[model samples]
Target chain A: MASKFETPQVRKFPIIPKLENSATSHLSPFKSKEEFQSSLGYPGELVENWQEKAIDKMGDLLGKYRSLRVYLDSCIQCGACTDKCHYYQGTKDPNNMPVGRQNLMRSVYRRYFTLPGKYFPKLVGAKDLTKEVLDDWYSYYHQCSQCRRCAVFCPIGIDTAEISMAAREVMDSIGVGQKYCNEIIGKVHKIGNNLGLPEPALADTLEGLEEDVLDDTEIDVKFPLDVKDSEVLLVTPSADFFAEPHVDGLIGYAKVFHQAGISWTLSSHASEAANFGMFIGSYDNMKKLAMRIREAALELNVKRIVFGECGHAWRVAYSFLNTLAGPFDFLDPRYPVPQHICEITNGLIDQNVLNFDKSANDDMTLTYHDSCNVARASSMGGIMGGQFTIPRKIIQTVANNFYDMDDETIKEKTYCCGGGGGLLTDDLMELRVKGALPRMEALKHLIEEKGVTHMAAICAICKSQFSKVFQYYDLELDQIVSLHQLVSNALIMNKKEV
Target chain B: MSFVTILYAAMFYFAAAILFIGLAYRVYEYAKIPAPLKIPTPPAPMTQKGVAIRIFREVVFFESLFSATKWTWLFSWIFHLALLLAAFRHLKYFTDPVWFWVSFELVQVAGHYAAYLMLAGLLGLLARRVFVDRVRYISSPSDYLILVLIIAIAGSGLMMKWFPSDILAIKLFFVGLLTFNFSELPSDVVLLIHLSLVIALMIIFPYSKLLHAPGLFFSPTRNQVDNARSKRHVANWAKRMESTK
Candidate 1:
């Protein structure tokens, strides 16, 4: 289907686009309906005293989160982060610029919370919390993917993600929640996962997966669900249970587990690893979601908890899990509380437990797209930049030809997949396609220069996003492959016992 | 004491009070609020010592800014380094027995020339705010005025070298203020203008974006240690929520 919005032309060399005033001002996500809003404990709709409530929420968040308070106060308007955002680069809307998006709420913050802004608002660029300003917050703040690429470049480490998240939180508190994030969060609360897959349905999906693997690999690689006394509890995103390319990665996890001879089971209780609560900046909801995993781990008596392939899921698992639902003194203390699947696969590859037939992936020359959250927000193997190396190591072991994209576009400087931090819904398809411009340009460069056909990603969002966006850029949809799907292809599941 | 002496002394005292007290309050608020999550921008250091080194590199070298854009880093670094040197040189006036380093010939010569570099840095910053479309779009009136204010201060200070002021009386006046002894301040127009702008910067330091200096130390993204997995980080507010669970 042709995109309703114009797709940004892939540039040969990336240049900062000229600022267009309100270029994407009309692209706000659908607001949460009454049921969706209240299910997450927010008001049903725009509250009667939303203005006062929003300012009060802002004041409360400023006190509660040091990141929100310090970041709002610390921006020097230096523009180091201006061209750093994919949204800004694609849309050319000044408001999509990290500083511009921040100034939306920062202006309000100054007006209500600072002394000078209280007296001389215009001089300091502070504005009253008017309807127009609040609308700008909703439209522009959603445009941000909370990627933190801007933070890596900021002089004072002023994270625009923190600002946008707080803006979202303040909006939700005043009954102005976005439908996509709020509804997903509500599903995770009521049902076990974002897709609202019930326990029996989850088991049925796993069973179908087991049969599919048996039909292909002719091995009894078990995709266990709710099996007590298992050695490991695998809490993957619900999308992995059914979505294309993601489900293949799930099969790869089963194959690896079978080969390594480590027993693992999925939890019907804490079925989701992608916590939308973090996207909305609700600590309460985030902790509640995190605690479900903790409860599952304790109830199943698992020795280790390993998260599957998801970007922000791994971030929450790697970074915030311990803080949110920790002292997992109950689980084995030797392992990291929640380890990443790539770390496990890489470890097995190092130990020579899982042998790979490198020629199995010889049909395509491959490149890796570092998902923004996993690359920048979280780490692997308890070492700096391990998140980058560990995944590449796994791919290199499994594939004969593996290449990386542009240096600046890969490691800690990696661009967002345009669908992360809950901006992946179909309603925001235009924003997603436009936001993918920077990443697409880099991928286009590799495809032309290096004969790269497939771009592998560990993030479910990245995979799904690329699958949709590749067609827009005239690349094949199948060009986007799961990192573990490559593993599934190359792994010698039935090696001769020698 | 002449009226100029008492008026300047009172102004100095008030400015000093605002700078210190206001800074303390802002710092206190930052320190009091707990960072509930571990959100260091990676590849961040994994230990406390490594995090200290990370923050030190950020502050002393403007490492992240350098990685971002060379132009911003060059202007900002030169401006900050020159400001520090000039502040160090001013210590000679305030101290009764100037420290050996402050009295050193190299310090005196370098400090005098630091004003030119300071002005150059500020001008470069101001030029960006005006010329760069991205920077100009974000630049508020106060952002421009702050740069201009500092430029004027440095310009007026540099002017005193050619249109000379009473250096000896200025030193004695500052020393007298320190020792609680009233003395006359030379009412040089340039010196008065310079001092007035300096006082204005001090009064606005805590309230303005000037807080980015001390605020950098409190930034959770820069200051946080990347040991969230190994060590469970819990804040007081979060702890209450956990207890209810």
Candidate 2:
């Protein structure tokens, strides 16, 4: 099984350094640019030299000291991930290839930032800064939807999406960020969400949506906000107030909570979980925006935080909340636990408090589209496995047809909807549509060969991207619906509660 | 200095310095790109388990490169391999004896054929850049300029090898210069051309994308992994909810 021609080994790190408190005491456990380089024997003087030139270097220093540095020092670029990314599969342009995309920002970042870099530039293929390279950085970094699907395929877990985010952040630090990414981040800072919708405007939008639900279903449903002493604080993406398929998912979350009799209220101060700041690699911005949600929850005295179906927001909730803002006491030790809508539905089912009639969606065969963020980068997926249990269970209870996509189409290997990392922007629609090819190719196969009629998605972004892909690919529009949409349609809600 | 030595030294100092110096500048420029360092950097390609498979696909088999363009790969492979051989063979001057006995055979063959191949490859790459609209569109002044200088270096090197010249004396003159002991030198026109081209390469080495060779190791793409879950495992507002400390 082994061919003889082999490459030399990289110098292995000795446990001695990690064990020696005298030398390694300063090393942080998590990945940090400063720690990784310091471990790599990079002299800190290189950074100090640059700091001397620039008076306003504190922010840059802290940013570099954070986990970003570890991410910067570790990529080897074996190109094994080429076939793993749905974007690459969709658009076969070598530029879109994950490794090539990572290199677009990475190679240049190394020369200016690392130690051996200052001495041996050519040995590493580092080039000097130019306006042209910056331009290329923007074009390619944005080209990444930040879908972590490729991460699922990496051997050592190199996440190309992280590279794209870091590239955008570096550009933003240098005042070179895209109008789209930076503007959204600014709005998230100034207002509550990327749309810059204030509390009054947000209330009006939700009240308007409640009225729409009443008109459609003849049921009076209120979307509550900023109520004190609630057991749960629910946060939804700002997109839900205006966006279509996402609105249905939001409605689905509301109904699931309503049916379960959970005391929850939305917080206008922290209305959205779609932290676009994350996409730009601004950890401070992400923390600032996310902290507001924490503040609202603490002030509201909620027992738990139920996050609506938003991708990156969920990622932040699941991945970063504990580390940056941790050891919560005001919250029930178990309180402030963020739950996916499916999790709530699944919880209701497990408690035997929910009933279902699958006949409503029986006309079509349903296939689930796993959102890239939830599937790869977060643990909420197990909840999906739990929550999605009900729709099928209800379908079986009512004798409806249910099927699945290809083996690779489910779980961690799920294809991205091609609009992740906020490519749903009008400016990026062409790129999004182009990048959707690989995922669509797989979906098209299911639609045509496997007789898949409806694609059930849990995340709002997936619903949005799938709808666009369905439209472009000339598939049925109604076929793409959120799991909640199906739940609302098929749930056996008590007539008295309605 | 003899006319040949002076002319060769003058030209090589100019050409090699321009080429290599410009390249160094380019490398530095690449490092200055506005990119954050949060992305993960992986280990050396040689360190990974599937490295052999990857090397086969990437370097030897030319899988993706072949798909990009057959001719680009052809020129690139020939240029890289010949340049590597030339560099290794030049090690003959650095040590008492050449350490790469295996590669020495390839270097001997290169001494015979690398000059013409490099000229052809560089010219082919240069022409392809000019004639092919796509490559031309991406090709910068430095990219084309680097190719021209490389052609000159290989050509001068081949010319010296084929022609009977006091190359040892010329080599010693360069050694003395490197040791900071510049003195009288042998008269050789071709050696001067090669030296100038080599010098030109050194000065410009820091300014280009070629710096990516080192930058790649520092790049987050090779290092960072998708560990968002490890960070996000806690519920929102857990601090406020708990806040015991």
Candidate 3:
């Protein structure tokens, strides 16, 4: 589907645009149909008493999630985070601002729950839960990627991501579901992966990948599936099996395992590392998805679990997995119960066991884009800022030339790929293009000044999103490469002595 | 007691009750709610002591805000620090014999001058709220009014320096209110207006955005330690789901 909206022009330097009301109001994604919603255990359409149901859901979430409750009350309108959101910067929509988006729900929270808003709504800027307010919530909440960048800047640590998640959860409860997220979540529940790839298809895809690796490197690298008693169970996003640059990353993971001589297998039961449950703010759904990994680990008797390159998926796996589905005391306790592939590869690099042919990646100058979730919401190697460092350490060791983008744009303050938090569908192509502006400006400057050739990222969404949005900025689609894709290029594989 | 004294005394008690009780309830709610996940914003502290230091920096230095925008940080830090000093200086009214530190020559001098800095900071913040396009867009009526209310309180309190209210009588009235004994409050117009505004602020503190003071400490993103993988963190409500599984 072609976008009716114009792509926001990338500026020389990223500057905060003036306030524009309702700028992205008409940019909402397609709503989930009855089947999609019902599959997720939500109503088929808008509930008859959606207003009351939404309010009740909000109250329930306020009691349940501490982030939502404290964040709603903590914002002092200090505007520290006013210019921190990528959507706001790109779209120039006031409602896209973290605080502006939060206020849409905050106003309703005040009206129904707080004293001042209850008696004096106008004075506090609280509003009644009318059709227009709900519409605004549907439109603006989807705009936020739940990136958590604003929380880093906020004086009180009031995360708009938390509020946006809660808002999404409330919408889901009221039979108002986003087609992209809800549909993906339902597919995960039904088919064990976001792509809905059944057991035989997943095995066939792995077999094909094995033959491709053999054809290229002439190494009998195996992509085993459901292999019992494997030492490691490799869980990755379904896109890794289907999409470009992403599938290349999956091949990289396979090659690493092949070199390290570690027994690893992909489970057909829990094939996806990307948990859309977190995007919808459904605890039950999130836990259900996580439990699949736990069950797969137990069923296969894998001693360790390693997650592949996915941004939000890493956050769920690293931060929420322990709480959601844990007591992994059943597995080996020597390593982090659920480790990242980067952690594994970095560990092997530290041990000096993996050799690299750095000249293989000399064709391009590379810089890494710190995917938002991995940078701010998750960690690697049990160290502070390890997520940013470990990936770069790998790139430098495996490749010849490397440069970082602007200091502010690279680390904890990294921009979202614009397609995260379940807004990656084609209907939202315009938003994805505009939201890529901040990142594109920095990347373009690096390319022109430093003579950079390719930008590598660890996230599946970042890979896909940049591949699509790069064309609009006059950059080549191939400029976006996977972190492990670089690794695959430079990795020196030793052939089996058969 | 005269009607003026009685009315003012009643208002003070009422405002104080709301301030303390309402704040206590809010704090209790915050404390009781379980943070189901470890969501400390990274590069976060890995240890409990490290988390303590992180929160300390956030509270004392406005560390996050400082990194975000220097102007907002400057105004906000100035206002908050000055407000602390001014609040400490006002404690002399309630203390029968002021604590030695409160009356220390440097503190007494600095505390008296803090009022000016506080006013300046408030004005800077107010100007941003009214002038900055992004800030102005997010500001509600109450946001501006909250600043105006505090400015008025500070202004009238400063006015007493020129108008010369009976300080001894005012102190006695506050002390009387603290105790069971009742006394007449000096009815200086500036003093009366200042006290009334102070009372209004106290009444609205918990119900208003001022809850940010306590809310900051309770924020999971700032207060949580980054050891999610090392230990299992399950809340009571979430634990129920585990049992069912």
Candidate 4:
């Protein structure tokens, strides 16, 4: 026998499967290529022979190639990352392995982008871009959640998630994106948010929520809709108005505002906060999605804008909001001074504006889950929200057993909930579960070993992912609640609970 | 011993110290990313039982390479193992009695094989970098310098062993350099080249990405526990609700 492993290797990875979707399909499983092109602000059709697009534009394409090549060429394939992947850890498949995952993207990228392709293609294991390779690209790229957990272990400072994102961008450009992502983008274009709920319905929902709050607590909270000349325009993910954990989070927001007595309105036009453009990797879609919030805010003439506790929403708001929205007439140059709800709570806490009856949130050991997008991608730069101490301060008063996971479990290198991007849709459940294994495995230890009773989260999708994990592993879903709900549960407001 | 030897040795030693110190500091800094940003996993799954097998397959068997292109893996595996063994076997410098053990005999044999592997691997690696157009573009002057330094170290060390140079004097020079002193290398041109190259690699290891040796573990992605699901990732509003209610 030549070797024993080779036989198994053949049986392991089957030949590349044929592609299901094509370039000509309408309403592309991703948005139709034309719609996608429109979003990218590109004039021509989505790149057909994308390899040709690399011609004469070495600067841009080369920039991507350099990022990929640097990452791949530097990695030693040490398998230091075999068990490190959330997916790999969840399902010990070699294919789900991070190094192999990166190699899939990098090897292909190298074949097309690098100079060796022109001569020694086979030497580099590069081949023609057949339909099979395209299918492989889609399956493997989608398999990745772009959580960046794998990037943390990459030896040469490589980032596989960046590679996956870039691949998704390329796929979206080529009209090969997933249905959930594309359909959501279409919804954002048509109805101002991916959920496809219109302004009237959103207004109706908010009104109902206000009524419910008054009925339950006897508090007169104004669910502001299209209020012109308001000082602040507050926006949140649609999940806040509808979903379980996040709905309570919205209640807490209203409570904070009621206590602070700040003038704010929720624009019925642009209340949704989830941005699918980030998933598909289109700047145009990203801009268009963000622009909806801006136009709605401007139409209502709000002085400031505050984003709810969604991770990527605040990221877009903080990073690209100013550039995309533009020079507004009434904007304070600092047009939308984006503020996190925690910072808002922390402000109240710091100023002693709010009182707490901590016993109301009793019988649970609560710990904080730093949503990866918010902590690593955005904040890690400065203090409070610019890298704040506020979240920790807020967590202290919430529950008793505030045990940390481990030294490496807390910051900078936090793992994503695999459902990031548009993967939270029910269609990608298996992948999400598989990808969530690492985080769940860690949580399992905390619950069993570290006495972690309640898992506190800020993002809506994080709630979604955590709930699924809780159910899958038969852990407590009710044990998971947003920090806002916990705060609202125990908020020592001067008025009585109605 | 000439002044040039002493001066060159001093510069090499200083460069090596700077490289080691800089590399250690950089790795520590990378390791210190704040808590909220951490993506911690439960624990390493690649523990002693399973990892020993994996390490053997990767390091001892080079099994991955057997499937890898013949030229590529053959050359690479040979080079890496050789270098590894030689480095480990070289404990003879510090511990004189190291040569007497059974493991030492195996190491000596492994050492010879490693020397051969080193020269061949270096040639193959360098040739691939030079001739392969893609690798060529990524390759820089510093990359080539490190490769050349490695070759020089191997080549000169081989000369000392095979030609039987007065190793005591040469080892004394290295010891002196280690102890904040420098003397002329007590050997001829081949040995001189080896001594200088060893010192040069130590110096260059820090500034270049080659320092990825330790940098890998410090990577937050690999070492961290994926405890994202366990903690209450509450928003500011939630915190207020929890505290106030």
Instruction: Choose the strongest candidate by lDDT.
Output: 3
DockQ of each: 0.90, 0.05, 0.90, 0.05
Q: Show the lowest summed lDDT stretch of 10 residues, model 3 chain A.
A: A1-10
TM values, all candidates = 0.99, 0.60, 0.99, 0.65
Misplaced by over 4 Å in model 2 are A1-74, A113-123, A215-218, A381-399, B1-245
Worst 10 residues of 1 chain B by lDDT: B236-245
Instruction: Give the Cα error of residue A488 in candidate 2, in Å.
Output: 1.0
Error of 2 at A319 (Å): 0.8
**List of clashing residue pairs for candidate 1:** none
Better of 1 and 3 by lDDT: 3
Error of 4 at A304 (Å): 2.2
Which model, 1 or 4, shows the larger lDDT?
1
- Ranked by lDDT from best down, the candidates are 3, 1, 4, 2
True-vs-predicted CA distance for residue B173, candidate 2, Å: 36
* Clash tally, candidates in order: 0, 112, 0, 56
Model 2 interface DockQ: 0.05
Instruction: Score residue A329 of candidate 1 by CA lDDT.
Output: 87
Best-first order by DockQ: 3, 1, 4, 2
The Cα error of candidate 3 at residue A274, in Å, is 0.5
What lDDT does each candidate get?
0.91, 0.59, 0.92, 0.60
